[model samples]
Target: MLRWLKERLAQQNEAVATAVAAADLVDKRYAAGLATYLQVLSTQNATLVEKRQLVDLQSRALSLQANLSRALGGGYRPEMTMTANAHSTVADKS
Candidate 1:
């Protein structure tokens, strides 16, 4: 869970960086050669909307990680562990 949260943070940073760069380009071109303010409004709206989802996912992942971290050494790890039983029929007879 911690690893998944870390990966989510990295991905969210990348996405926000991309939005920042796009906003910068839109900033430079808004006045002279580009279209009206609608483009800026649309881009900003989209960036904000995308960020809302990323923020929600990030919050959930971080909260889960923190809860798991707090559960360490409390004898509750097994309660959250995920195991696969898909290969149980093909056991090795040692």
Candidate 2:
């Protein structure tokens, strides 16, 4: 889960950088008379929307992971699976 979180953070950072660059490009293009203000607005709006989505998703995933970690007693232990299954079998026999 930590690895997954790290990867997600990296992706979000990269995406944000790209979006910023794109926004800058739109501004440059508009100033150069190659594009209109409307085009600039559209590009910026799209990038903002995408960044918002990425933030939302990352936050949700991190929240879920944090809750899970807390519930699992800090972090995952592969051997806990066997213990959980054993408990389930014992409870069933009761």
Candidate 3:
């Protein structure tokens, strides 16, 4: 499950990148009057939603990894906790 989540997270990151690029293009088009403000807003919103999903998947993957570590008696490292907290902070900011 952790491996699957990691793969999903990777895919989601790619999707977010694509969405961001699309949003940038829409913004440029809007500035050139080739696209409406609504189109720009829609693309921006889509990008934000994609980013949110990516963050969510990251959180899930981290959680799964931590759980797996615990199950294996490897315990949670301080760096791992810190990384998870950092991810949560990013999600909150987003």
Candidate 4:
């Protein structure tokens, strides 16, 4: 899961960079061509949302991995888990 998140984050970074470049182009075009400010803003927002989603997904994947590690009696994995509390609630507490 970590590997997958790293790969996906790399891809998203590239995509975000491209989107920023495209937005720059759109900005320049707006001054001299048919491209409008609204168009550029819309694309920027979409890419921003995509980047945010990538981050959120990575967070969840790490959480699940951490929970699995603890449940399997391994080390804490040095990361946090969203399911840790829920799982503990169902099981007996020492």
Listed per candidate, the RMSD to the true structure in angstroms reads 7.5, 7.2, 12.7, 9.0
Order the candidates by TM-score, highest first.
3, 2, 1, 4
lDDT of 2 at 31: 92
TM-scores for all candidates? 0.60, 0.61, 0.72, 0.58
Tens digits of per-residue lDDT, candidate 4, 1-94, equal: 5677778778877887887788778878888877988998887897788778777877887788788788878776444455776688778564
lDDT of 1 by residue, 17-88 (tens): 788778767877896667568878877876887688688987897678567667674434534443323244
Error of 3 at 56 (Å): 0.5
Global lDDT of each model?
Answer: 0.71, 0.83, 0.87, 0.77
Candidate 1, residue 77: Cα displacement in angstroms equals 14
lDDT of 1 at 75: 35
Write one digit per residue (lDDT tens) for candidate 2, span 11-34: 877887888888899899999999
Q: Which residue pairs collide, candidate 4?
A: none
Q: Model 4 compared with the native: what TM-score? A: 0.58
Number of the candidate with higher TM-score, 1 or 3: 3
Which window of 10 residues has the lowest lDDT sum in candidate 1? 81-90
**Residue-by-residue lDDT tens digits, candidate 3, 1-94:** 5567868988998999999999999989988999999999899999999999998988887887788788868876656778989999999999
